[model samples]
Target chain A: MSAPAASLDAVRPPVRTIGRDGRRRLLAAGLVAPLAAFLLFAFAAPIIWILGYGVADNELASVWPRVSAELRDGGDELPPDEAVFAALAADLRGSQASRTAATAARRLNYALPGGRSLVTQTARALADRQEPDPGGGWRETLIALDPAWGERETWVALRQASGPVSAFFLLSAADLRLGADGLERAPPEQRIYLAVLWRTFAVAATVTAAAIVLGFPVAYFLANGPPALASVAMVLVLLPLWTSLLVRTGAWVVLLQDQGLVNGALMALGLTSEPVRLLFNRTGLTIAMVHISLPYLILPLYATMTTIRPELVKAARSLGASPAVAFWRVYLPQTLPGLAAGALLVFILSLGYYITPALVGGAGDQLVSYFIAFYTTETFNWGMAGALAILLVAATAILYVFYARLAGPRGLSLG
Target chain B: MTARRTMRAVSAALAGALLAAPALAQDSVTVVSWGGAYQDAQREVFFRPFEEETGIRVNEETWEGGIGAIRARLASGGDPGWDVVQVEAADILLGCEEGLFEPIDWDRLGGEDSVIPGAAQECGVGAILFNEGIAYDRDALPEGPTGWADFFDTERFPGKRALRMHPAVALMGALMADGVPKEEVTAVLATPEGEERAFAKLETIRDDLIFWRAGAQPPQLLASGEVVMTTVYNGRIDAANREEGRNFAFVWDGSVGSFDYWVILAGTPRIEQAYAFLEYIHRPEVQARLPDAIAYGVVHREAADDIDPERLPDVPSAPENLAVSVTQDLEFWLENAERLTERLQSWAGQ
Candidate 1:
């Protein structure tokens, strides 16, 4: 160690002598540090916080700690002792007197339907009477107030709801639930999230595919055409992006309605006797989404396609290769990086679409983001919303990893 | 070293100024309600008058109906910004029980007997009475729908229908269409068989149904001929007819009436000012002026006595209209909304 240190000291610069490269590196990092810190706090912190809601169990635990503790200790079976009932009585009376019974009731309702009324009613009934007679009558009184108290499912739900963290929300997001035995598929009628997730992906994939097919020709023309025409075409491509998404979707609604311009033109030409059902369906959703997402696909492809020299194709042709073979082997493979970037961007954006589908699409056409908004805004189910959001983020990340694997190292650069 | 210190001092002052701006502006009471024509009417009839009379600046904001925004604001463990919020009956009950709202003293505004029956609650005061009813474009459906049953008779009506997406009013309408009596609707809905029966009845018109989420969409749907008939907020149809000259006819039979109430958030610092504004809006004369401005029914019974006889029929709380219309069972909805909404969403997806 002493020999190596002596050699390093011999080669090192004198003390307090700073080099140009070292100074530049320090300045660059100093300039970027604020932005990095801002992103960590502003972007990453909120995401991590929201993701934490999926595993939060404070609502039930905070309001009815005694009952929750008893339930947790009782395990899977219904507690045979009357002490559980006394604890529940005390908790309910406490919550009712404080007017916080609804919080605990709402938490339990997530597990058992109608548990809100069962809890609130029992609390109100007990609130009217004295402290349970300190006897076996407490159980009978609770059952008499709400017969649901006697049900095993109620006890099961109570036990499940008492948690520091549980897999209930994550399982619910996948349309599964924890039963007495183990995790099982949710009832067929309640199996909605899986189907909704599939539809979200299906709609996003269709939009991405349509955007690519329609955008490629336009982007190619702009890339290869004269400068003036290219500028005009570029402006035309970007004009819709400048407009509000609501306005663009509204324009589609106006044009695709039964009595709208398209239908009027169709009937005027005697194409059909009746107006077609064009709006408020999957067809309307795809058309509108493609129009909205086309610019994303076009810009990236245009950037890449314009960089491909015309002489490359000419050189291939000079080697006696047919035009089709040369174009297929040389041109298409060169554009894969841009294609990957554009497809990933459009697909990720489409997966979180909320407004366009809610306005233009039919009831069944609504996506998972719509459900996220529903749970967050309408029902105030933050846990469910967080779980669904995590699923979406994870899904997008997985897709990105796959794209990266397919596109190789150069794929990171969108251009 | 001096330059760096100065830079730090300036940035600190700027941050402190940013933080102090909102604190200095806290004298005004923020009022939140449904936007569009509804908020416009409140601004004209309630907010402007209250500000003029009380000298307290009123900051008006708009929100679409739901307690989610309120819950979000309160979740941050600080003042929830708004002093008063307009909420529906079910939400008022739920929010009150959850301790999200302050218990209102009805005697301060008027005695308990002064407010309309079923409108007074422990933590909220009824602001308006509204109904959800079938409406049709006069030019398109001249015969018009007579009742909910006619709404379901696609064979005779022979056109698409727009219904609200939620289960509360829609399920009640479905049960009514299936010939269940008004008083028995809640009882019937309590059973699984009743729910199945309602869904089965709705299935007959599934192909013809276009579900709408917002109150404003129904009139637009009817105007654009997207649907021949829709269940719309009675006030929206009235406003469209009066303002746009759209000849839309309302079917009052089988209509379901409910109330929207004003409640103060539990942790608001402006409780006295909030109560004053609430008191001001509930004045008999102020309530009377509201019908002409927004076309919604008022909860002050005496306010109805002040309206012109010609305009009284448009009010949902008119004695004749109330006789035919069913009052919404708020307790039932508050208890069952979570489960029923999930079921409704699943059904819509199917």
Candidate 2:
């Protein structure tokens, strides 16, 4: 074999002399350049921007950098000197005139609720002033304007909020907070995010499992059946994919409601006496999510299954192996790559599922994405939203790594 | 290939020029509001008329209620999209204090006293009065729900109840259902025991409750019989009855009346145009046209006379309806919304 290859290579044209290899490599790179740049800007940039919010604490730092620096140098304990106060007064005065006092006030309010008015009122009072006198009665003036300025907690909150990076959002995401003594578990009332995270994972996992169980059989049938029948089946499987997820979810809502088609049929057939509460609960969420995710699982599985030859299973069966044993050992092993790919795809997609769950699922069935949406669109807490999103992405990445390790490199491909 | 490339370039430039064409003309003001009939009414009563009176075009946009979009826009630094926004009272208060909105010149748009009492704020002019009230499908539940108490009384009006998935109105409903007087709802919500009492009252009907976040959901829920009764915006229920031929009746007792205000974004070039639109809507005649168009109440007190007397009962600010309704305390919501929402979410998830 080596001698024949060598002889063949010796007879081949000297394409290397024309710089063909470099030109081919250059062409490949050039072809992918647009895609790579697109991915960088559209995908990686947004992820970096969102992840950056986890540590990017600038709302207060931008306005009162001097006060923040002083607070950081003086430690967590509130400083008694008028330097911090003077810095705050000067920042407030500048911010007020520039119309950015509200942003600073809002930032402070996040740290200490109602801190907004205190800052805004003080800023308005001092809007006419240009400078903060170090020796002057600025402290008394500030204290008189808002008694909160005299408090130590207020100072601590201000210092904590004014930072280049803080674990406030990340810790809050984990239902932990940075207390006086450092990181501690949030109070029971505040410990909601952890449960939401767990619920999100649980819902995603259940949907993935359901997709696998329901999709595998259909994919197998499509792969092994007669070509004409298989083509028709494939079209049926892809039909749901053609419809919008919202429209499909809405269809499910109509089909599963109390007086809807499903219940109406069930009653007509004498299957049950009463209409089951099926639309806004865990059952409804699982059904809708599994339906939405089935195509993701089926396409990949079908792709892998089609590659498996019938002769392999026949060969095993002819060797006196039982049909189930032969199929499991020969056919199932071949489809492992597809199964892993499909499961992971379904899992990842389901993890970020929002619309179907929001529309069909009850309040208890809501996932972390719901809260992320609430914070992002309803409360405008980008820090909290970013933190939750980062947690979700990290969780998905970790899951992918774990799946990759289990499936090996070849199994990672979606056929 | 070169010819095609040049063609592409020429077309791109032409498209760009076409896009920038509007920039040279009279400036257009972007007005954001809750979409559907409400926006339609505003377009008919305010936007078109304002545009006709002044050559400044009014660009209409729709937003589901929240200050988050405005905050996101502002956070990105420059221009916050819409010039004039329709905001809830609590959001307006918060946005005004934070300077997200430009302070209204009450003098220009009829003095503070000229608008309905409590409708005028430092940065917002009250546009319309909307109510969150019990709405029941008359055909579904013949013995319809009368108020929050009847809503909570499942034995009397037994069905799945849809409530707004928020702390403010939900808590108030719970308190009223628990027999707390309308005036004392906020005072009771202020105390820990009051909060606990409200939650406990809510707990009784927790299993039968289906929560809706958007204003559009409640009427749909009622019409589909998915929920026999639900807390819905007064105008939405009215629209459903009028348009869909659904016999949905609103229960005014224990209804929470909240005002939607027209707020000007802080740093928009069309601030003058936004103020002009706001002033135009503040006119009694323009305010009166709103009720006939959408069945929502006008904030201008004198506009009541201009409204059809036969349609008065349907308006949220109607004398009979207003008598039984509790005005939502925007201040209380502004201060406690965060804490209460967190608690509400935790409870809801459980």
> Over the stretch B1-350, how does candidate 2's per-residue lDDT look in tens digits?
23543564366446545554443348788999989867887888788766655556889899887776788888776787779998878688778765789998888977898876668889988878888889987887787878888888988877899888888879999999998999899999988899999999999999899988778778878877898788888988888888888888999988988888888998887787787678767867667767888878888777776667778889987777878999877766755676677778888889
lDDT of 2 by residue, A108-152 (tens): 776665776677788888989765445556787788778888877
Q: In model 2, which residue pairs have backbone atoms overlapping below 3 Å?
A: none
Residue-level lDDT of model 1, residues B4-100, one tens digit each, is 4356436644654555444334457899898987899889878876665565679988888776667778888678888899997869988888778
On a 0 to 1 TM-score scale, where does candidate 2 land against the true structure? 0.88
In model 2 chain B, the worst 10-residue window by lDDT is B1-10
* Over 4 Å off, model 1: A1-22, A128-130, A134-141, A412-415, B1-40, B43-85, B100-113, B264-283
What CAPRI-style quality would you assign to candidate 2?
Answer: acceptable
Best by the lDDT measure: 1
DockQ of all candidate complexes: 0.47, 0.32
